[model samples]
Target chain A: MENNNNIPIDDLTEEFVVNIGPQHPSTHGVLRLQATLDGETIKDLLPVLGYIHRGIEKMTESLGYKQSIYLTSRMDYLSAHINNQACSLAIEKGMQIEVPERAKAIRIIMAELQRLTSHELWWGSCAMDLGAVTPFFLAFRDRERILDIFEGNTGNRLTMNYITPGGVMFDVLPNFASSIKELLVKVKEHLKEYEELITGNVIFQHRLKGVGILPRELAISMGCTGPVARASGISCDVRKYHPYDGYDKLDFKEIVIDGCDSWARYKVRMEEMKQSIHIIEQLIHNIPEGEFRAKVKGVIKLPVGEYYQRVETARGELGVYIVSDGGNKPYRMKFRAASFSNLGALKPITVGAKIGDLMASMATIDLVIPDIDR
Target chain B: MKSLFQYLKEVFLGFYSLWTGLKLTLYYFTHPRKEIITEQYPENRTTTINIPERFAGEVILPHDENNKHKCTACTLCEMACPNGSIKIISVQEESEDGKKKRVLDKWIYNLGMCTFCGQCIDACPQDAIIMKNSFELSVYNRNDLVKTLNKPGSKLKEKE
Candidate 1:
């Protein structure tokens, strides 16, 4: 027989490699993390991506400006409305279209509601990732109310192509304000329940409090945005700095935490959910009664040039860039995915932490995998 | 003595936090009417399935009584569709004045590829089509997915 030579028992190294998932549930989508471990601590971690890349950007090149906006919703399905807003803003910018006041108010309301839904999903899944299953059910129970509200107005729950070039697809329903007020009350009450149930738990705190610390400089250098960066004391909320759609006029505070750890990320999202409610409360009662959508030409052809628009999605900043050849379809389209940039910081923050803390780190970053892959 | 005091305080604080979490769960367990949950899907369909009226499921070309439809076969829905799921096959016919006029024939819809973006309905100037809220659209045959939206022997309704 030929020599069956492998690494001899005497020469075995302490460092070993472990694959978390290209198809694991904690990942929330198809994301594979190859972690090199020395005993229990991760020596080095590398994220393997592109498992669910549906060629969304390339597909946008062939589709018209109107059709291409819907593809972004599929990219970050949790931030579907926000993704749609960014794409619409880019098109609206290119064509010099002025979105009506009523449309702007509706857009803001929908965007903030989607943000709450996204954060609720994150909160539930974050606790679930750390081994508690109850929060998942609790989170979805609250989320269904918001999705019901979305379905009533947008006609679809997840990938609502409701936000379009000049304005939204349709006007808000008659009971929109009353339903939102009712929802705000319910969600506010549930937030207190969530605080009691998971936020104060000793085990959860010990697992999260100082684990996977991401400092301010590292956060900025990594191009992190949204709650992930804010948790690290980096005030990079695009809403505050570069306010779009009616956010500038609204009275609200950006929830920035200086904890620089997983717990801070958790707290930041919780507070942000409250801020989202505050934003919604400001706009709901006073939605300008006027035309829902402006008169956009049947076919949208962006003038020959490059165009860009950025919006703060649930995870972070989503930038939509389009290059037009004076045609209905874009010559090239690029999505600056916040998850991809935020994913870069995962390895740096988690390399020296225990392998078990990796889940805590991943969950707090709040990555929606299709957002990263797209 | 001081070190012992610190250790005791840590244990007490830990237990207190854990109790708070458990307490919330206990409250929910005791009070049951407020808890929201879902029913079994197929079973609920016969009992209390309440799908929203605005839910987009499948496209249908609405036909009026007297076997008349509103489609002029403009093919705008075909152009509006991101996927080429809709095809308009029109035919020309001679009127009573013997003048040749183009008219609607077949509206072929591939439900398999439809994203239900509702762009097709929005593009129809005639308001000839609307999305029905019936979402139970599963069939054993693949060919059943491709629908001939316009009924056979239906004529286009002239504007009153």
Candidate 2:
């Protein structure tokens, strides 16, 4: 290292760069972080994305309305059901098809269950990121029950292309209500176990308490939503702001915390899981008896117009924008994914934090990288 | 005395927090049988696992005793597939009514590229193709995945 400045060769601490993933386990997917480090402190952080980009939006242009909905499931695999719902809702809005009450209730139930699973996975991974591995096992145990319920009802577990434009692809199974009730009871007990495992631990608290302090204004300006924004006191829950499906009918609280730290983000997701359970309980008993699918033509062609619909995924707001030119295929399709926007707030909060702190912050951000890349 | 008191307080607090965290894991470890969540793959294949009825594993055409399918060769599934997973091959033949009618020659579904979106099953107006529950689709060669849905010497089910 050469120092040109006359007065300060010894005083200047040379800053070096470190690359934290494109393949690191903590990244949760293929996200490369180019961090400028002065010792252990991150001076600057830049996230390099698109390692997993499959051109989902571009592919949607050629696909018909029904075919395009399936592509959204691949974008945010963690919240695939919600992603599919957003796309369907947008098409339904354009086509002006009223989804049946039963279908709406089922959609909300599925979305809430999907939310719980996503958060459960997040909780596990977040704990694992901070060096506690047991929570991963504990969280997955409960998450498997949710996946079982999803598989039993929707046929597939992860990429459930079950939600369609008119309604769900299939009706709920006969044991849907009982299975959910059983799951809700188990989950309630497990949430306490989770709290005991990590939330109240001094080590976990010390790592997360004041690390990555994101202010509400910064979160808002960065276009953060879901738990990340809500943690910062932004109150940006799309379910609360603009209710869709049967969310308007069911009652639930939007968990917001003013801590603006990693702890707050973690707590928000934890509380949101409880709220998801609450929403599911309210609707499971009363999934109105009616047609699961609304009447729609074989080939769905939306009139020439622009349509936009947004739904709250476990991560954040998933907005589906479709531009149709009086054709079966959309002329243009765009997805405003939550992870992509939340990834922007990472550098702002993580800068000046330690390398260990960066992992804590990133974990709390709860990024599903395909959602970012897509 | 003050310094001693501070050190003891910190020690007690730290141990208490650690104890709280370890308690749950200890309970899980002790009750291993009850807490075990993993499904033993391959070993427990026969008794434990029951694949759900609607599981979208592979697309198949159900044939009747007469070796006939319900496919009209409408190319609706081909159009519906997001990927070019479904390929419909048809031949124009003069029917008994002396009119040119397109008949199905081959309905090819490539399992390798199939996302199991159920769009093809939904779009099939004739209820010809459906997703089967057999999910063990792994094969030695990729060519094995390119399944021809229609049975050999199968004809379209005649209109009732």
lDDT per model vs. reference: 0.91, 0.90
TM-score of each: 0.97, 0.96
**In model 1, what lDDT does residue B67 have?**
88
Best DockQ among the predictions, by candidate number: 2
- Each model's iRMS: 1.1, 1.0
Q: Per-residue lDDT tens digits of candidate 1, residues B51-75?
A: 7778888999888888899999889
Q: Which segments of model 2 are wrong by more than 4 Å?
A: A1-12, B1-7
| Tens-digit lDDT string for candidate 2 (A233-289) | 988888878888867766788888999999899899999999988998899888899
Worst 10 contiguous positions by lDDT, candidate 2 chain A: A2-11
TM-score of 2: 0.96
User: How high is the TM-score of chain A in model 1?
Assistant: 0.96
| Candidate 1 Cα misplacement greater than 4 A, ranges | A1-13
Q: RMSDs, each prediction?
A: 3.3, 2.5
